[model samples]
Target: MDPVTSGILVVIVLLVLMAIGTPIAFALGAVSLGALVLDQGMGELTFFGETFFGHVSSFGFVAIPMFILMGAAVASSPTGRDLYRSLDIWMGRLPGGLAISNIAACSIFAALSGSSPATSAAIGKLGIPEMRKRGYPDGVAAGCIAAGGTLGILIPPSVTMIVYGISTETSIGRLFIAGALPGLMLAGLFMVWTLLACKLAGGYNSPNPVAQAAAQIKENVEGNVKALIRVLPFLLVVLGILFALYGGVATPSEAAGVGAFLCLALAIVVYRMWQTKPIANIMRDALRESVMIMLIIATAEIFAFALSSLFITQTVAGAIADMEVNRWVLMGVINIFLLVAGFFLPPVAVIVMAAPILLPIIVAADFDPYWFAVILTINLEIGLITPPVGLNLFIIKGIAPDIALRDILVGSLPYALCMILGIVLLCFFPEIALWLPDLIMGTGS
Candidate 1:
């Protein structure tokens, strides 16, 4: 069979496996291996062990667990709660203030922890009940967290970027820097949508008219100052990491290590919950989370290797490049395909499976790969809020079980549209993603 035909069959089989509830890692590795064995017999199987082990054996990949540890450690502490409370007191006066604050907290937490589910769970646990208590609509409250959570990977120090970089041999550092402006841009878009949604929906519901009036009046006097003081340390740590990485003072791994240690130390000192057992438990959670991700990554390596050896990836890219369609139209079509695929797979799986096939086509069309990364990341962001496999939707459901999954999904639609707008913005102004990396790292692609 032609490589294109074989590649198409492999994808169909992989999707069937996923639809039938196979784990992504397993489906990916299984389909790849099946193709290999069919093409060249069991002797070709020896490549699997080396590829799987070697892919995970990178110093660059070290940043993934380190960043996850940092996030888990912070989540185990009071930082998330404190950050929310701080933003809440200040942002809580706006239309849908609590919801706005939820997005703000998620963005900040995204900076602190580069994992979407962690961002959602940590902020959702704090934001949801409070919003519900404030009479914010359940769907609105849940949706905001669900949407905001997607920022975790678009922000710097992102684990998704790490995996993409490792897979594509893109400079991880530049990818990290490239994400900053776009991440902030998406966060801004979410906030705008929240404000507009709440306004149209009759705004935030206050618990007590008299108390709210009194609190707002007091907030006029001293709240901002107090909130600033309360949040400064946490903000400083997040800023310090960004400054280190963006300033070229540290590699991503070193930066992650520093951020993890610093955040852990801050968590202990400020929360003052440095008991032996609690600390041990915090580390244990981080280890558990890290191990789970590492396993998926290890198996994904097998899939990546099989795709490369079979030339399926390059063949698909070449075919797409050879198409007579306008390049921008092709980009749009490719994005649509990604959006559909994202409904069934997690962000990591989408990137691992598609980047190899689509990236070269993107480059061939003269789209900046760095800029394309931002656009692709936005697609992944939408995936996090999308249904069936929308990781953030399920995350919010897990955190706020009473909020129906349908409500969360419905609420996320606007924000998902906002993310689509962000993608359009990147498509028009690739410089939004390129400028920061070029300024900081001096451009290479």
Candidate 2:
């Protein structure tokens, strides 16, 4: 069969399996296995074990579970509440301050957790109710949390970036640094829109009387101090890990190990979670999520191998390359494809399956792979809040069951636009994404 026919059949079978409730890992594995058997006959099954194991046996992949454990530790504790409280105390008086605080909290938590759903669930649990209490519109309240959570994949220690780096042989450190600036830019955009939205909605809260404000500040002084102290250790750990990674003090796996240990220790000491149940819950959550992601990575490797064996990878890349299209136009098409893929697949799956195929095309177009990583991430971020499989949107709904799904979707739309604007700005000023990585790591090329 022609590569095009085979590619379509593979996609159709995979999608049908997924639509009928097959797990992504299984569907990917099944399609790849079937394709290989058909293309190469039964002899291929003899080496399937080796091929599958080889895909996930990388030492760098260890960073995934360790980072996930770090996130799980932080998520299982009261750290999210403390971070929100700290930001709230400082920013809560500004117009739409509560919502802004939520976005800030999400950005910080995104750095800590490196998982969007965890960031959303942790911050949303506290921020959503608090925003609702403060007379913030439900749409604004839900929108900020949902949108802010997408920052997880764009920030350092990001599992998605790790997967992309591993898939494409890009430097993980450069990928992390590449995302730092763009992530902050996107967060700033979220905050800017939030401030404007609140103002346009006649403000989320009325101004407090001078005397009442002073009294409220005095009352919360001790608690705020305690909250800041509680939140400081986690921030320090995250910063330390980033420094280790960027400063060449440790490999990604090594930094992740130390970060995971420190985060778990802090969780135990600060939250008094020494009990078996809490500790076990953290491990269980980390293990479950880690296994899910690793399985997808392994299966995606198989899928990619199948595509290569079928000549689809080369065929498609050659077809696109032969078009001689404008680089930006090619990028626009790639972004659309990624956005659609992301609507159904998680970030890791999309990165592992698509990055290998896209990276060469992007580099052939004279684009920096690291910068494109940020762009690809922002595209996927939009999908996290989009429909059918918008994980963050569902997380918001679960957090605030009474909030209409329509309201959550409506609220998240503006933030999605903010991400698109972020992409546009990055395109016009590639330095926005490239400058940091270049400054620190000296141009990844």
Candidate 3:
């Protein structure tokens, strides 16, 4: 069978399985095993365990769970609420201030949690109700939280970046640093769109004067100060970990370990979560998410390996290289492919299966790998709110069941457009993603 034909068939089968609600890990594993068996006979099954194990048996992969733990620790606490309250107090006076505050809170919490759904859940729980209370439309309220949550993957300490780094043999620290500026840029875009949207909708403030007075009272100086005091330590811990990683003081895994411990400690001290249940809940949430991600990584590795063994990866890369198109044209095509892939698969799975195949082609085309990383991340971030498998959409629906999914979807579309705009801007000015990494690491090849 031709590699292209086989690849298409494999993808079709995988999609069918997923369409029928098969879990991603199982779908990947089953399809890969079938591909290998057909290509190399039943004997190929013997090496399956080793292939899967070897893919995940890396010191670098340890960072995923640790970063997840860090996020879990913070998500399991009241940190999201504190962070939201603090931002709302400061920014909520502006037109659509509440919506903007949710985006800002999501960015900060993204740094803390690094999981979109977790960020959405933590912030949305508080943000959605507050925004709705302030006369923000349900679609806008849910949309902002859902869109903001997507920031988790683009920000530093991102688990998806770690996965991309490990898969492509790129420096995790450089990848993390590479993400910082673009993450902020994307957040700023979300805020800008939100402000404009709110203004167009006659502002986000409630009409009731009594409610207005209560909002002002709630935003009092003392409460804002206390909120900041509670949220500051977690922010410091994230910054310190990034410093340690980029400064070469520690490896990604070491930085993550220390970061996780400190985040858990802060949750304990600030929230007084001395009891076993909250602590156990943190560990439990971390374990569940970590296991799911690890399984996807392991299975996706087998899938990638099978493609390589069957010459599918090389065939695809070679065909693209042979196209002899302009680098920018190639990038545009790649971005379209990535956008579609992301709409279906989670970022980790997409990176694991596609990055190895795409990285060489990207480098060959003279694109900066670090810059491409940010673009790829933002592409997947948009996927978190898109349809059929938009995880953040469901999370928003889960939190605010009264809000129509269409409203959430409608609300999130503009933010997705903002991400697309961010990508286009990055294309024109690659430095938005590259400058920080270059400054810290002294340039890249």
Candidate 4:
């Protein structure tokens, strides 16, 4: 059979499996294996095993679990609660203060967690209730948390970036730095939109809920100084990761190791969480998440191997290169496709599946790889809040059972729009995502 025809069959089979609710890793692997059988006979099955193992064997892949462990440590301990409390104390008095603080807390937590659902769960648990109690609309509060949680992958130490960097052979450290500016920019945009929403609605303070929330705020204010003191170590962990990665002091993997250790130490020593069960639970949860992610990556590698062997990736890139359409127009079309795909696929699945085909075309278009990474990251950020399969949306729903899923989805729209706006800005300016990485590491590094 012709290679293109064979490639088409593989994609069709993959989709059929996915549509029936097969896990992404299994779908990818099964399709790749079937394709191998058609093209090279059953003897090629051994290659699949080797490919999967070799892909996961990378030293760089170590960062994923380490970052995950760090997040888990924070989650399983009191540190996460303290960080949220600190932000609530400091920012809760502003217009849409609770929601704004939710964004702030998400950004800080994203630095540690590197996973969207985790960020959403950590903040949504505390933020949604407090905002609702304070007379903030349920949709608005839930939406803010859902949208803010996307920062987990957009910010530095992002697991998605690590997967992108490793899969594409881009510099992981530079990718981490590239994300910092855009991540913070999007967070700011979310905050600005949130504040505007509050002001236009005559402030988030509902008459009855305001009185109720006022009392709660007053009670927390007396201990604000103490809360700030408790959150210092978490602040340092964020700073330390940035310094280690961008300052040329350590590679991303090494930085992840350090961050994970710091989180563990803080939980056990400072928080005095000496209980064995918490530690055990943290390890178990982190291991489960890490294994799931690694499996997706390994399967994606097998799929990419199959595509490369079929020359599908090169053929597709060549076809795009020959197209008469403007590169920017082509990029916009690709972004639209990714945005839609995000509704059905997780970020890792999207990155693994699409990056191989689209990345070559992007590089050939003279688009800076770093800038495109940010653009793609922002697209994934929007996907986190989109409906049907948005992980963040589901996370909020899970945490706030009383809130309607429609309300959560509705609330996330503005922040999603902000992310879309951020993408456009990056496309036109390109400098926003590059400046920090360039300043710290220079363009070549």
Candidate 5:
């Protein structure tokens, strides 16, 4: 068989495996190995080691653990609860008051933790009960937490943005800066949905005002502010990491290593939670996650290499070019494809699989890949909150099982629609994404 035909069959087989419940990393590795053997003979398998070494050995990926540890520190420490209470007080007066607070808290927590599940788990723990007590529907509460927590992936210092940058060879700093606007934009969209849903459902039910019980809420808010003040050292540690990288004082990988140590020291000073118990546990956990991701990346890279070597890029690109659709129309089409596929797959895999295929068309149509990337990330963020395999939804469900899956999924509809709208707005006007990156990185350097 021709390389193109074999490559196409390889991908189809991989998707079949994935649809049949095979793990993503395994599915990718299996097809990748198959492609190498069938198209180029087992002799070429040597390239897998080189590919693995080149991509996985990078220091930037260290941010995955650093950010994860920071999340764990905040999760296990006293500070995490306060962040939620603070956001709750500030945004809780609105319709779906606690739901609004969920969005606000996720963004704030994203700033602190920079990981979606961390924000989801932290806020979901606090936010879910608060909303439940306030007479909010269980599904709405769970849905808000699930959707809001995805903020971690898009905000600055976001592990997803960092990973995307490393994998795509785009500037990590630029991707970080680029993500700022769209990340916040998506957050804003969620806020709007929370408000509107709560507003529309205003007539559904009424509860005795919990205004009196708010004494504890107010106290919690104040405590959160105080915790923020104490956590300033940790904040400084993170800020210094980002500032060093963005200001060109350090490369991203170096900053990641430095950032990890700085965060550990800050946790020690402020919380004094550092002992052999947590330290050993944190390292072990970090190492485990790191090893898993590194292995997946290694295998995925080999898979990507074989597929591309078979002209998958040009073939897919040519197919799209032959469609001869207007560039904007094509953007819409790719985005819709992503949103639909997102319902079934993890967001990262969706991006990895599609980016190589899509970038060529994006370039041929004169659309900026960076802009497309931000737009693509937003669409994937929706997937994280959407039904079926939506990752964040399950995170909340695990935390609060009394909440029916249908409610969480149904409550997510408005927010998901808002996300779609956000994507459309961004597609029509690229500046929403490009503006901040342009200011920070200065014209594609």
Candidate 6:
């Protein structure tokens, strides 16, 4: 088969496998194998071996598993729970306040983890039931958790940025810095819209039922604060490492390792949440998840590697470059297309499949990568709330299986609109993304 035809066939097979519910890793590997065989006969099987090994072999990839471990550790231990309860008390007075606070919590966790599904799975365990028991609307309850989960991509330490940096040969450190302002802006948008929506809905926030007692609210607040105080050491440990990395005192890989160890010690020794059984369980779970994510990453590498080799990516890039529309018009079209694509693709998968194509066009037009990354990240965030294959939505549903899918789906729309608004606001005033990167990289925009 001609290479172009083979690449096109590979794309078709991948979409079919994805549509038919093949796991993403297997779908990528399978499509790659099919393409290789058609193009180079059975001898090309060796290339699959090479590709698989090459994908997992990067030293930088170790950061992914470590970050995953740290996220899981915080979730299982008391630190994350304490943080949630504290935020809950502070925000529980307003309509949908607890829900909005949950969004805030996910945004905080997002800075550390950079994986949306992790943010949902972790925050849902603490946030969902608490909000429901407090009489929060079911759909509003579930929507907050799902929408908040998207923070993991927009925030600093984002795995999406790492992947983007790696793919584009940009500096990952700069990408991390680039994401800071935009992540917070998106989170702020979620909160503002959520506040308005709750007021308009009139049935959203759980009354300060406990808080009306004054004494009871005070007790809860004090207890949560004390618990959070105990968790501060761990938070500090993680922060210190990232801070050093950010200030150029250490590299990201070194910081990740340090952060991982600090989390382990805190989880086991300080939090006292670790028993032998739990420790074993944590390792097992972390390993299983890490392997699944790594497999997908590797397969994506193969697909990207081969696709670029065939210049199919270039063909797609050329098409986008040829369009002479206004940049705003082009951006709007790009964002709308991405939102539609996000409905079908996993966040990382969307990034992998689309960024390469869009990026060259963006660069040729002299648009900024950092700004584009933030913009695309926001688009992917909306996808998490989108229907059908909205992965975070389903993950939250899995946590609150008792909650109607309709409820979660219904609640997500307002938040989704808020996210879209954020994209538009950022599009017009890109300073939201550019400010921090400028300050850090010394490149005044």
Question: In model 1, which residue pairs have backbone atoms overlapping below 3 Å?
Answer: none
Give Cα-based local distance difference scores for all models: 0.82, 0.92, 0.91, 0.83, 0.74, 0.77
Clash count of each predicted structure: 0, 0, 0, 0, 0, 1
User: For candidate 3, which ten residues in a row score worst on lDDT?
Assistant: 205-214
Indicate the residue-level lDDT of 436 in model 2. Answer: 85
lDDT of 6 by residue, 364-427 (tens): 7778988888888888888888876888888988999998888889988888888888888887
Tens-place lDDT digits, model 3, residues 35-78: 99989999998899999999899989899999999999999999
For model 5, what is the C-alpha lDDT against the true structure?
A: 0.74
Winner by lDDT:
2
- Report each candidate's C-alpha RMSD, comma-separated, in the order given: 2.5, 1.5, 1.8, 2.5, 2.9, 2.4
**Candidate 2 off by > 4 Å:** 206-215
**Model 2 over residues 1-445: C-alpha lDDT tens digits?**
9999999999999889998989999999999999999999999898788878998999999999999999999999999988987787688678998899899999999999999999999999999998898788999999999999999999988999999998999889889989998999999999999999999999875244243567676767668779989999999999999899889999999999999999999999998997999999999999999999999999988898889999999998888888777989999989999999989898899999899889999999999898899999999999999987899999999999999999999999999999999999999999998888888878534
- Candidates 3 and 5 compared: the better one by lDDT is 3
Each model's TM-score, in the order given? Answer: 0.92, 0.97, 0.97, 0.93, 0.89, 0.92
Candidate 1, residues 1-445, lDDT tens digits: the string is: 8778887888799889988999877888788789889888999988778877887888987888888888877778767777776676667667788899889999988887888998899999988998888778887899999999999998977889988887787888788889999999999999998889888889884433346577676764465456446557766877887788667788788988888888788778877876898789878988887876776787766776677778877776776788899999999989998888778877777776688678778888888877888888898788889877898888898898888888999999999999999988988888889987887778653
Minimum summed lDDT over a 10-residue window in model 2 is located at 204-213
Which has the higher TM-score value, candidate number 4 or candidate number 5? Answer: 4
Model 5, 61-165: lDDT tens digits are: 766666666656655555567666555555555667677767877887787777777788888888788788767877678877888888787887777676677
Model 4: per-residue lDDT, tens digit, 1-445?
Answer: 6667876777778778988989888888888887777778888987777898998999999999999998898777765577777777677667888789889989988887888888889888888888888788887899889988999998987999998998788988788888988899999999999999899877964233245577765667656557667768866896898888778788888989999999888879877888898889889989999999989888988887888888786776676778889988889888988898787777887888788678888988889888888888888888888866788888888899889998888889989999989998898888888888888888778
Ranking by lDDT: 2, 3, 4, 1, 6, 5
Model 2 has an lDDT value of 0.92
What is the Å distance of residue 37 in model 6 from its true position? 1.7
